[model samples]
Target chain A: MIKMRLLNGQPQNRISMADRAFQFGDGVFRTMRCTGGAIEFWARHYSHLEQDCAALGIVCPSASILLEDLSRLRPVDAVLKIIITRGETARGYSVPDQLLPNRIVQLAALPAYPEQLYQQGVKVRVCSTQASWQPALAGVKHLNRLENVLARREWHDPDIFEGLMLDRDGFVIEGVMSNVLVLSDNILSTPKLEQSGVSGVMCEVIFDAAVQHGLQVEKRAWTLDEIKQSDAIWLTNSLMGLLPVSDLCGRHFQSHAAQLLLSGALKQLRQKEKFAIVDLAGMTKG
Target chain B: MIKMRLLNGQPQNRISMADRAFQFGDGVFRTMRCTGGAIEFWARHYSHLEQDCAALGIVCPSASILLEDLSRLRPVDAVLKIIITRGETARGYSVPDQLLPNRIVQLAALPAYPEQLYQQGVKVRVCSTQASWQPALAGVKHLNRLENVLARREWHDPDIFEGLMLDRDGFVIEGVMSNVLVLSDNILSTPKLEQSGVSGVMCEVIFDAAVQHGLQVEKRAWTLDEIKQSDAIWLTNSLMGLLPVSDLCGRHFQSHAAQLLLSGALKQLRQKEKFAIVDLAGMTKG
Candidate 1:
């Protein structure tokens, strides 16, 4: 899945040893999907990147600069990862007065996940590694992701598509790399990331579409039993899009009507945003 | 303060942007003090590094390899930082079948902290940023230190030497960059890092010496109120050694006898180790 990489808009594959991201993981990143040379939800992704960087006190690179870098790649049907680090500075946690954030944009082949899993839904297990509670870092998607790495390492079963992680208080927060939504009757609920978990962009887009679809959206702490009791469970990410959880432990969530409804809405949203970008052609001219 | 950097073993100053350390903070690190070209408590530091790597499933570089790299620098009165990452691999959280850990050894000038701070004690304020609860990650000096970075960023006042952080439960944890020890009468107490916090090597040495000195050692959770009522508080790290906190949120700690006693013991330990290294001269030949 590996391909080309650009550091600070140049065709470079290495960063300074002193770079804060390499040294302290002082950075934020966005993993976006680009199809037919057009990135899905470009505006929302840039906005989220800015917010995540602001949360960490690192200056966000301008959208034009990132767009220019993206244009350089002219990615077609690829996974685009944009990382903005606090840049290289002296060895310390203290943010330097002269903030020089470095932008890294890379392209990789879209992962070849089996289509049958998405169609029939996937099987996920509850991870033993619990998520840490950091209200400050919660929902920002900063680079301090060792917890997720550890959680993902729990199972090597190719049969398990993803792992569900809970906060220290035993509240189910999110999937190892995806945001989760629980469906019951007309209410669509997801865990509030105020104390932990990354507030994913795909989850945001889904919630917006759900509201327009006349679904009552609820965001709060979710217990494991509550999750299991739901009519259906949907895991969403920028790359994977959306996948229903058919089996969690021994319980089977056979109802996937909610997943189909949201998947169609998500496709509509992606197409609408693609047509809305005035510079779509210009974005690839570089 | 950075003087030199060695990536892997050679004197290189950059690493692959795909390195796990930069990519996901998938790494562990050690910061040690090198005086007279000898790393203080080298054996203990190496053991801690091995344990931390094992905790995160990253392979630890053998000590002789690291010591050989240190000898290449021939560092004297410098601060040494060693970072071991899970190495570069294809994208995703799944641990690859093959693991190639990368070692980064760098040298920075020994911090020139104000001399009087150790003698008269320093003033510290409680940080607003709370340490996250990650029992699995606790005590490992991994590179996912955005918590410490955010806590340290809470204040820029040079008058305040450090900031004390509390866990989600409002219990005193540790300094933003050091382990904290609370002294009340004959009891030398420190927060148990089982829930959250990095267990500093210097704190370990102090506790060992404290036991030998006939002081009762207790490790458990300590509340803010309990910390304020302590006789004196000391912050310990590899480089800064030990510093007493004379004032915390206006509560004064007049006792310095405990700090003095520990300081003496630490010096003796360092001297004892220096004489114990038979390869001290050979180590610098590189």
Candidate 2:
């Protein structure tokens, strides 16, 4: 399938070299699954993108403007990515007075992960590379992702689906590309992103669904020892939806019980949406 | 004079959107001053840029290739910036097997700062935004500079020349756009960048000159209180050379003594360089 790329609504694959995003990674992006010509969880994605941009003082492009750009792709069963940059400018870190935000919309083939992995769960490993401690940038999916790239490079084993990252203080923060959660005593606990980690949209959705299913939810710091002792562990992101961690650092977890309960709650939420679903799992229609 | 930008030696301003630098800031850069068609400290600038790229596992372009690119610019008394990105690739963080680095050379008009800043020293304020700690990327000047952008946004006062940044642990790091050094008693000291901050080219030069001038140099953790009590403070960068800090956090400092001693030492060093006789001020032939 041919991929589609649009820069500022133009069918272009190039941006100015001096663009702040190219110069300093001064940008934020959203990756959403586009199914049957409609974006899944688009509202949640846009809201997160706006908040990320606002955290860096970059003015976000209006929702209508972005939606218009998405429509231009005429996407169907594709992975859609939207990038909002502070725009092109002269040299230096101080923002220019007259700011023009750049919007890039791209469409690619949807990743085809084996269906069995969703049911059987995937294996993960702890990364040696630690996440930087920046409270100001925590929870915002900004473009400065060198640490994530480095962590993702630590393992070459195809069986290890992801690498979990810890902050400098040895607190479990997140995965290289997704947010992580641990289940213990029926309590669903995700890391507090006030000091590190990207707070994924799906993670928030899982928290809401877990609450609806009468489960305790906690957002706080977690250590490697605490995670290893949990009843179950899960990894979440927009594209991959959610998956249980069958093995993490040689420790096995059985997440079938909690998965069924929350999956049902998520299906109920998906039914209220506009898109027609073929299969509903973990708040994502696949 | 018109600014010149060369992408891979081609006089163009656009780069592929898929370039890793535009995507994940997977790149390194160097900024230097050109005087009468000759780049100031070209060897040191290239060495630092190469080391930074190596730290990130990128292949540094040959010096001959970069020098040729600079020669194409026909730069005379301008600001030159060199950027090397890990080329272009499809989505994801995994480094592709086939790698090609992209080189960008840009020449811009030299900034015309009031000479009084160099003569009487400049006032700098302490930034509220703290630098993140990532030991792996501590000294490398990579493109993940959103923190710098955020810290620089703290002040808009024209009189405030720079902002001093501290790490998350409250240890002095560097300036928003430069490296900082403090002189106390008869010793010169700079922050240890093993856990935070960029180890700039000019900062290394200042340390060497301070040592040759019979002044002791120290690199270690420094607190705001300790910095406030120092005999004098200074900021260093490739473009600005070195400037004394006259005022910081409303406290005035007398840097005249240190400035006279170090500037004289730097002037003697410049006399042996290839560049003709000019105003040799703080290792910069301005």
Fnat scores for every prediction: 0.85, 0.79
TM-score of model 1 relative to the true fold?
Answer: 0.97
**Candidate 1 segments exceeding 4 Å error:** A275-286, B275-286
Model 1, residue pairs in steric clash: none
The deviation in Å at residue B17 for candidate 1 is 0.9
Q: Write the per-residue lDDT of candidate 2 for residues A205-276, one digit (tens) a residue.
A: 888889977899999899999999989888888777778999999998775688877767666654444232
Task: Point to the candidate with the largest TM-score.
Answer: 1
Per-residue C-alpha lDDT of model 1 across residues A21-133, encoded as one tens digit per residue: 99889999999988887888889999999999889898898998888887677678888899999888878888868788899999999987677877888999999899899
- Give the deviation of candidate 1 from the true structure as CA RMSD: 1.8
Inter-residue clash pairs, candidate 2: none
The per-residue C-alpha lDDT of model 1 at residue B27 equals: 98
